[model samples]
Target: MWRVWLLLVTLLGAAGAQEGKVGPQKKPSPQNAPSGAPPGAKNPCESPVLDVTPKPPPTAVLDRESASNLARSMSRLLAHQQERSAQDRAGALAPSAAALAKKVIDENNGIHAVGVGLPQINLGLLHFRHHVVIFQNNNTAYLEHYWKALALSWNHTSGVWVPPFLECNPHSTEIWLHGFAIALTVEKQRAVAGIFRPLRLDQCDSMMAKLFGGPHRCDEETTKCVSEEGRGFRRAGYRCECRDGFYNPGAPPSWRGFPGEIVELDPNDVHRCTACPEQCNTCNSAGKCGVQRDPLVRGALLATQAACMLITVMMAAIVFKQRKCKTIASGMWTILETILLGTFLLYSTVVVRFFEPSVEQCLVEPWFRELGFVVCYGAIILKLYRHLIEFRTRKAHRWVVKDVDLLKYLLAMVVAVLCYLAAFTASSLNFIREQYKLVRTEETSSGQLFLACKPLWWDYVTEAGEMLILVFGIHLSYASRNAFTQFQERRFLCAAICVEAIVSGVFYVLRAFYVTTLHPDYMYLAYFVRSQLTSTVVILLIFTPKLWYQHKQVRSLAQEFSCRLPVDAFRAGEAGALTADGDVAELNLADMNPEDIRAELKRLYTQLEVLRNKTLRADNPHISKRRGGRKVAHRRFSLQKKGSREKVRRLVSLP
Candidate 1:
């Protein structure tokens, strides 16, 4: 090896010094030298027969004139190829890696570089990083691959480039395994560690390992790493083995320290395992743990939501049917309808959350759970406060807002809420935005990943709004608790809002503090409690009594209407209707949740107010220019001065 280098160095010096001329040759080191080979094995690095060692002379490589001509010819070749045909007019074709590597080995006197190098060398025609083996006469090299083309960065020097070393013929039958292919059935990219050849897997493992104390591991992603007690070759108490039905095709003797270790060259370097082929699942390496979801839990939620929605719809229908009753429609029946809608929306949130928290589900979730509260509870609080005002103003003997006036106030409040929600949704509901999403997913350490749709950071916005409503409702409920207009309705309203506040507070607290450590409580109990609060509190406590009272009073009231009782006679006849004796002893307000007679006046007032005059024409009827207006209200009833007032007194007296 030294004799060959001496001859090349002499030629390079002589040719570089003067005008292209041969120089005086140096004496050879000896007849025989260490060629980095076994005592009897033939060194594939050198040609067996060629006198010139089968390569262009080093002097020709150094010749400046020859290099200039080579550059010009390369340019002309590119131009000529471009002009060959329109089929390749887009651009010149790229040379395949096999052709480039074969040319490299042929030019280097058949010397082959080791498995690994800096890939940058493959960029130019001067040298390459990968190994290329050419067997018999063939168009392509038998093997051309970059196993572990690596790089070195200078620690001390400011700027330096490390040149690669051509260590040995990587494909030499005695040295390396070549052209081994790994087959994968499931995961495609996990074709393992045999990819790095000259790199020695141990060195790479040490570089990337963060373990403080442990056996250096093989790549688990691509190989089946396991503990072992016996060590051999480069393995640290463990050996690399090909899976059954898969064998090392071109491995060095004894499979690089398998059960029978025959490590002839570079025995200390780590030997990596190669996969069998792409079509084989025999070597399937699974690194991920199995994940499972509990179908029973999700099914429970789905059933609960479906049941609640049905009950809410049925109750809403009953309320609409009983809308004509004064107690049922007290303080605007529209408010009850709005509350039902909001409660229905709240129930629907569970259905929206039935799926995993995807972009679409997360988007719809906020509208159902958050804005639904705004619509439902917003109506409740406003109605409670309106009741508070009505009670006070009635005690003061003053006229206050009518149903339409109250509705307009509700519209204003809703519009403001809509504005705030609109701004929030537009800015926050961007499909990808993390904030403003209603529910977020979390995972467990047991490889069981479950999405809770749990409370997020943005839930505070909606929560805060709900808190304000509940607080306002509490205050309104307390102030109106003693009102006499709607018997027991004030008490029922107070109970409903208080129950809501309690359930919401408890649900949120559990979700915040203990739900993660104790889940399915949040999924089952917490969600059920919060979602069904309206059904229990508002529907049962507030509306059920009203419906029952309407059912009881309807029969009696219908008989009175048929008899055409005068207004004054009906108002004065509560004693006769209740009992034979003119006494209040028989009527128990607490037990009966008795219907309020004065509420009948308010119901009549609403009826007359619908045909009221415009503000500017306060003394006259507010008639429209349309061809047909509410004149049916005129022809069927007297519109004479004080006629509407006299009519209302007559209707209210019937209660």
Candidate 2:
């Protein structure tokens, strides 16, 4: 029996040595064996705890009862032996596995170990699989399966928590290797071992369901998440690798990277990833591009449209009022008002153009904006010059014909300039439409059509021309500031021009920079603000005064016509009665003909002259006696003297 026992031990030892040559071997200590598993029974193929390989058929036959008894005895013996070996192997691996788990946990910052899921299991000849539950500092848990764990090492680069024993495919599915796993430095030698694969979407869903007690949708597969299944793994997880046009909207607002940069699937989150808006390729929680204009821009555009409409109405009223004032020839002023109205219309169009982008509107809006600005300013400058002429000549009629002829020339020149600019603009826009139709970035959802244009040199050229004219107008107004007939008018005109020029210049500069940095929506808002400000300032300066003056004139006319003549005053023959200081009080001339008015005024003047003569006679009666020494001489001299005095006053007051 002793000899047989010695031979069995020797054969078992030799078999273990032979198996060790295929891959690295781990010798489990008997003292450290687990309580349940027998000492050398952890890996049956490695140690041959029962040597259960089938013998060459059955040797001999016997009675049924005898054969059954023998089979039962052999089974008991094998079970007892296997149990002892498993205990031994468990004891041997326990300390090492514990140390290894600790080392891994320590290497991975400060994650806590939530106990081992399964003790290390040598699936094949040499390779072992370790199941460890790790809790991240954030309270999130991960079930990590370590393959070829005996030789595990921390990979400092790549930031992946890959075991050192695995030779990871960097360019392939992260930490994966193809072909049969050959013995590398005595590690696992299985057909496909030492490979790590993430859980598949379904597996992750199952795992998440198990953890949180609810069904969970897994993150979709992405390019960065590509990986092959190894022995028992699939590629999927909570790691953020969002699909194209799909973003993790639940990510932190401060996270400005591409959509899936740092997707968090904490318990608080509803969905890990979401699709961007139809018009967006990538977006934030608000479904807006990173550089997109805010909602305030739309509000501002609406406001601009409202202001343009209101100003348009006011301008139209002013023009109508000026037309009604037939006493004042408002031909040039009418042209100016018309130009302002056109400017407001252009502003309205520009505002709407941004609200909805159409190729046709884009083609014409730029021309409209530029031409309206030039012509509007040109008309205003012309009005200023015309006013200066009237002031210098001091005769409104002197420049009437000249102004009419000059206005026609001005209109013709404006038309010519507009035609030139329109041609240039058309050519440039056509080129843009033909040549640059597609967006440069493949990820951008905006169509190939150009939404906006950089100010070309020719664009600046036209702007510079406009600026030169505006500056010239400013210079002329400043130079003839004192020459203006009304200082108030000059002040308002200069102020409006200065405001428009400054505001427009600033807007241009800001828009140039904003267009380059921000999306077109923001630039649209800036344009709206600029257009409204320019039109408003112009209207306030030019049209407001005219509207106010017309209002006052209308009120005066209404008051004049509404006045009533008392019957007592009419009976006293005071049709145009003179007050205490020889001033004629207003009389109600309602329904009176021009002839009746002329006759009444003449009679009143005769009465006033007779009263004046009576007063003079009372004051200096001696002069009447001495003058010419005759009644005819005195009367003729007094009449001549009064006529000479009226002529002197008229000549002195001539400006």
Best by lDDT: 1
Worst 10 residues of 2 by lDDT: 135-144
Q: Candidate 2: misplaced stretches above 4 Å?
A: 1-244, 247-300, 303-307, 310-314, 326-333, 356-362, 393-403, 437-451, 484-488, 519-521, 553-568, 576-655
lDDT of 2 by residue, 317-342 (tens): 75666563422234345665656755
Q: What is the TM-score of each candidate against the true structure?
A: 0.42, 0.42
TM-score, prediction 2: 0.42
Question: How much lDDT does each candidate structure score?
Answer: 0.47, 0.45
The all-Cα superposition gives candidate 2 an RMSD in Å to the true structure of: 29.0
lDDT of 1 at 135: 16
Each candidate's clash count: 4, 24
